[model samples]
Target: MQAKIKKVELRNLAFEDYKQLKNSMVESYPEMADSYWRANDIERLLGIFPEGQLVILVDGKVVGSALSLIVAEKLVDKKHNYSQIIGDYSFSTHNPQGEILYGIDVFIHPNYRGLRLGRRLYDARKELCEQLNLKAIVFAGRIPSYGQYSNKLTPTKYIEKVKSKQLHDPVLSFQLSNDFHVLRIMKNYLAGDEDSKEFAVLLEWNNIYFDESPRLINTEKNVIRLGLIQWQMRSLGNLEALFEQSEFFIDVVSGYTCDFAVFPELFIAPLMADYNHLTEAEAIRELAKHSEPIRKRFQELAISYNINIISGSMPYLENGNLYNVGFLCKRDGTSEMYTKIHVTPNEVQHWGMKGGSEIKTFDTDCGKIGIMICYDVEFPEVSRIMADEGMNILFVPFLTDTQNAYIRVKHCAQARAIENECYVAIAGCVGNLPKVNNMDIQYAQTAVFTPSDFAFPSNGIKAEATPNTEMTLIVDVDLRLLKELHEHGSVRILKDRRTDLYQIKKIEN
Candidate 1:
C-alpha cells in the first residue's frame, strides 16, 4: 500500500521494541495488513533468529521489515504435479545445494509510503542473503501482491529474469541508463516447485574501458650535417700563434659551402675570456672587442656559401661566471646563441663555470633547431627534451682528446638523433691545442648519424674531417624528402619506441 512522502531511516534492529513498537505495529497492524512486529518481538527475534531481522526506520520508527522462516515439509507438493524433475541436493556433506535462506515476509507500515521503503527493505534482505553466503534466497509471494506493486515489487517478476539468470531488472535499468545491453537469461527453480512459479535471475557486468598509447606517423628519415670549429688561438698558451690557422680554417669552411658549420668549444677565443695571457683588465677589454670582427668573418663565410653556421661556443662572462655558449648564425648574419646548460664536473670543480638550465627550440631559415655543447649531449634527455619541444635539428659542439673514449662519447650524439627522430650535427675538436696537457690529443672519429644508419648513405662517407685537419664537409640535405621518408617509409623504427615504459630519469638526468 502507498503512503505519504517523507524521509525515512534504514537500519537493522539492534534494540528492544516494546511500547512504541506495540502502538505503531502490533495494535496498528493487527490484521497483518501493516507490520508484524511489536517492539519486544524485534528484541526476541534478534535474540533467537538474529539473522532474519532486517528492518528500516522512518524518523526513529520501524517502517519496514524483512523476516525469514523455516518450514519442515516435504520438498514436493500438489503444486509439483506438473513440475520438472532435477538432481538430488542437500546441506552439509550430503547436500550439493548447500544451505538456503528463505525470505519469509517483508512489510511496510501503511503510514510510511511513497518513499520506496519497500525496496530498501528488500535490499536489507539481500544483504542478509549474502552475509549468510547462501546459494540463493528463496521466497513465495502472491503474483498479485508482487505485480500490483511492480515498481515496489518484492520477489519481483524480474526475479524470474534473475532466476532464469537473465539481466537484473533494476541493474539492467541502471545499465541501460549508462548505455549497456543485456546478453541472456538463466533459470533456476526448486525442482518440485516448477509449477509453483518460484525462481531467480543472474546478471553480468559489461566491458567498457580501454588503455592505449598514442602513435606518431613516419618517425624517421632525418639528416643533418654539423661542423665544429674552434676559432682563434688553440688552447690558452699559443693565443697569438693560431690566428693564422683560424683564418685558414675559416676560409676552408667558406669554400666548402656545407649546409651547416659549427666551431669548437670556445670559438671566439679571448673574446669571451675576461683575460688575455695575464694582461691588464684594460688589455683584456680590448681583446673582448675583437669578437665582433671574428663573428663578422664567420658571418661572411655563412652568407657567401649559403650555409647555416653555429659559431661554436664562447664563454660569455656575464655577471660572474663564464657561460659556455654557441651561436646559430644564418646566411643573413642574423645569429642566436644557445648557451650550454650542462657543465662538466671539471667546469664546476675547477673552472668556476656554471651550467645553464634553460631548454629551448627555435625556428631557423633551414629548419627548427636546438643547441647543446660537448658535455650536454652526453645525456639523452638533453636531446629528448629538445625533441619533445619540437626541434628537428640539434647542433652540438664538443671539445675532446684523441682516444676510444671519443668514439663512445660520439655514439651518444648519434643515439640522441636516431631515438628522438631528429638530425644531430656534432661539431667537435679536430685540431690540437698546445696549452692544456691533453688538449692536443685527437679524440674521436667525428661524423653525423641517423636512425637507420650514419648520416650519409652506405655509398658515401658521413663527412668525417681529420684531427688537426682544417676542412669542411658539405652535404646537401633534402628536408622535404627526409620528412616524407619519416612519414611513409618502409621501416619506421623511431615511431615504434614506447617511451612511457622507459626510465629516462634513471639515465643520469
Candidate 2:
C-alpha cells in the first residue's frame, strides 16, 4: 500500500522541530554516518536567517525540510571543492546582500518518497527566489551511481554519460529534469561519501526572469532597432508576388540586424486578385480568406530570417463578424494577435468591420511593447493604458489613401510618444493600386518617433522615409532613455498625471 500524505503544511523551521528534523535527515541518508546536523548549528542558522530555512509537515509530523543560504557570485567564481566553498558546512560566509540563493540540503522521509514531496519543496525554493528577486539558485548535486563506475570512467566522463542519457545517476538525473544544468565536476567535494566517490557536480538554475541587460540611457545595448517598411501598391498579380515582396523586406532588415520589422496595414491587398470586380465590402471579405496562409508565411519568414515581424493589419472574418487584426511573429515561430480596438466609421461603413475591445502589451526579449493599428493611435487613452502597463514601445501600422489621412496618423503618433513618454514606430502604405477599388491611392511617410526631451532629437523624429516613397526606414530607439524621461526629465507628464481627479477603468465582459 502507498502512503497518502494528508494535510501537508509548509512553514519556517521552528525550534521545537530540530530533533525531528535531525532524525529525518539521518534516516534519509543512512549510508553517511556524519549526515545528521547538530542542534546548535540549526539554532545558529535559524537565528541568522530564519526565512531561508523551511520545514514540511504531514499530519502534524515533520517529514521533510529545505535549508538555504545567500552567497555572493564571487564565492563560486572558479572550480573548487564544496567543503571549501561552503566553509566546512558552517556557512559562515553567507551574505544577506548576495544575489544568489545557495541550496544547502533538501530531503524527504522514506514513507513520503513516492508522494512527489521533493518537487513541492523545490517549488517552494523557486517561489522564495522570485519573492527575493535573486539572480539564480546554485548547489552541488551528488551522483550516487558514479561510485560503481569510478574504476572504469573519470568523474567528467561519468557526467557526460549521464547528460547524454547513456547512464542514469539518481540525484543528477533528478536535478537535470528540474531545469538545473551542471557547471562542472568538483573533486573531493565530500571527503567520505562512498555513494558519489567523494565527488559532486556543481549545478545552477538561472532565473530567466532576471533582466541583466545594460540600462545606460544612451548606450547602444539599450536600443531596440526597428525596420519600418513603406509598402508601394502596384498590381495584384498573385499570392506568390505578395510573399516575395514580404520576404524581400524581411531579408533586408535581418541583414541589418534589426530587432523588429514593421509593415503597413493591408499590405496583403495584392493577394486580392479580383478586387477590381468585387464590391468594397466583398473585397475585404475575400481578403479574409487568405488570413491563415498570410499568418503562416509571416511566421516562416520570421523564423528563417531570425527576426521579429509585425505582420501589419489584415481583414479578418470570424463568426460572421469582420475585424482588422495584426499578428506579431517572433523569431521563435510564436505569435500574438492584436485586433483594432477602435474601428473608424469608414471601416464600418465601407468594409462592414466591427471594433475590438481587448487591449494588451506583449513581453519580448527587447522589452514590453504594444500594437495599435492606424487610427487607433489617435486616441490618447489607449496608449496611456499601455504605458501604464510598462510598455516602452508601440508599433502603429497604417493605410491612408490621402495626404490628410496620412498626416492624422503621423501627428497622432508623435503626440502619443510625447504624452506617454514612450517610443512609437509608424509604417504606412504608399503609391497607387489603380486596379484595386478601395486601395487605388495611398500617401505615407514611414518614421520612428520619440518623446520630446533633452535626451532625444529636437524634432522628435529619429528616422523617416521620404514622402510618397517605397522604402524601408531603420532606426534605433533607446528604452533606457524612456525610463529616464519618466523619472527625471524636463517635464514628467506620466508621473505628474492628475489621477486624483479622474480615472479610466477598463470594463471587462
Candidate 3:
C-alpha cells in the first residue's frame, strides 16, 4: 500500500472541502447516501467548534474524516437515538463548555478502507479529548455486519462474536481495535441502519490523563499488569531497525492490555554493530550517542501503544563520563530517567563508567515506581531508599554475561521484593552478539517477583520466562496486596523496620 511513501495529515475541516468529503461519505456508505452531509451542516459544525471537525488527507486529498462536538454528560448521559443526540442533523447538542467529546460520525473513503486512515481520524479525536481535558470519547458505532446473522443471533450475541474475533463488523471491529470498549448494545439507535439491523454499540475511550487534579481515579491503582521482554542479542543494521523490533513487541503486548512493558539493559547495544571496529570503551561511547533518539522514539511508542515503558538501560554519556541510564516513558507522552547508581568493577575498568548518586521514584498511572539497573539491584540500600519514598514497584533492566551473574540478579531481586514489600520485575538479554565486542555474550531469565508471605506466590516468583531464550513474561501484581502486606501480613516488612537504629541515607550530588 505505499503508505510509507504517502504523506498523510489530520487537518481542520474547511467549508471548501465539504464536496470532497460528501463524495467520500457516499462511496463509503451508499445505503446512507440521502444522509450525506450538507454544506450548511459542515459550516454549522465549523462555526460551533472549528477544531472539532478533522480530516485525514493522504497526498493532499481528503480520504477520511472525524466529526465531533463537546457535550455535557447530563445531556447525552442516557441512551438516545441518533436524531436526538445530533439534534436532527443541525448539531444542536454541541456545547462549548461540555466535558465530553462526543464523536458524531467518522468515515473513510471506500478506496482507503484497509489503510488505517480511520485510525488516524480516531487518534486525532483522542488527542483533542486530551487537549481539552474531556472526560472521554463517546460514540454510538454501527455493527454493520449484524444483519447477516440477525436470523440466528441477537444484537448482544452479534456484538460478542465481533469482540471475540468469531465475526467481523466493519465499523465495530475497527472501533474496538482503536481501544474503544462497547458499553452497551443499543437498539433502534439509527432508524435506517439496515446493515446494523437498527442496532449499534455504545463505545467509549476514556482519557487517562483527565485531570480532576489531573489526579487518577484514586490515590493508587489496584492492579497493574507488566510485560517483560527476555531479549535476544541480535546484530542490527541501524537504530531504526532496532526500534522496529521494539515496536513489534510493544504492539503485541499492548494487544493484551498491558499497563507496562520492560526491555532489557543495553537492548539497543545490538546497534553497536556499526561501531564494533572501535575499542570496547570507544564503541560504547559511540553507542551512547543514541540516547536522545532512543528516548524520543520510545516516547512515541508509549503514546502509540498506550503502554508505560521502562526503556531498559542505555549507554548514556554525559559531561565526558559514561553512565548507564533508563527512561520511564509514560503513556501520557512524558518521560523520566533513572541512572544506574552502582557500576560494576568490570564497567569501571573496561568501559570507564561512573556511578549515579541521585536516587528517586516516579509516579505513574499505576503507582510510584523506582528503576534499578542490573548491578544496581545488588545494592539493597538503593531499593530501601526508594521503598522509603513509597515506591510500589521496582524495575531492573540488566545485561548479564554468565548464568552465575543472572542468578545473583534473580536472587537479589527476590530479596528486594520481600524486604521492601514491593513488586520487582527484572528483564535481561540472552544469546550472543558475536560481532559486537564487550557485549558478545548474554545470559538472562526474565521474571517478576512478589513479596513472600500470605496473599502472594509461595516461591516469591509471580511468573518467569524460560532461561536463555527470547520471549515475554506477562504478570499481574496487585498494589493493594503490597499495602496489605505492609500493614497486616505475616511479616510486615515495611512497617517492622527499626528506623531508630539506622536508615538508608540517599545523598544527592
What TM-score, to 2 decimals, does candidate 1 have? 0.47
Off by more than 4 A, model 2: 1-221
Would you list the rank order by lDDT, best first? 3, 2, 1
Candidate 3's residue-wise lDDT over 1-509, tens digit each? 44463687879999999888888788878887476788889999999999999998878877788998888888766879888888898888888878889898899887777778888888889889989989899999998888899999999888898889999988898888887988888888998889888898889988766665545444546789998988988888888888889999899889889999999988988878888789989999999999889999999999999999999988898889899998999999999999998999999988999998798999998989999999989989989999999999999999999999999999999999999999999999999988888887999999999899979989999999999999989898998677667655887777777889977787766
The whole-model lDDT of each prediction reads 0.53, 0.86, 0.88
| Comparing 2 and 3 on TM-score, the stronger one | 2
User: Which pairs clash inside model 3?
Assistant: 211-214
Report the C-alpha lDDT of model 1 over 297-415, residue by residue, as the tens digit.
Answer: 66766676677777777555666556666667687767776878888766555455677767777776556788888888888877776776667777777776656657656788777
Question: What's the lDDT of the predicted structure labeled candidate 3?
Answer: 0.88
Tens-digit lDDT track of model 2 for 1-509: 13565688989899899989998898889998978779988988898878989988888888899888888878876666766666776878689888888888888888777677788888788888867778888889888899899999999999999989999997898888776888888778877888899899989987644444435462234678899999988775778788988899999999999999899998888676576578889988988988888889999999999889999989998999999998999988899888999888888888989998898899777778999999899998888889989889999999998999988999999999999899999999988877777667889999999999899999999889999999999898888688668755899988788999987655677
Best by TM-score: 2
Off by over 4 Å in 3: 1-220
* Worst window of 10 by summed lDDT in candidate 2: 212-221
List the pairs of residues colliding in candidate 2.
Answer: none
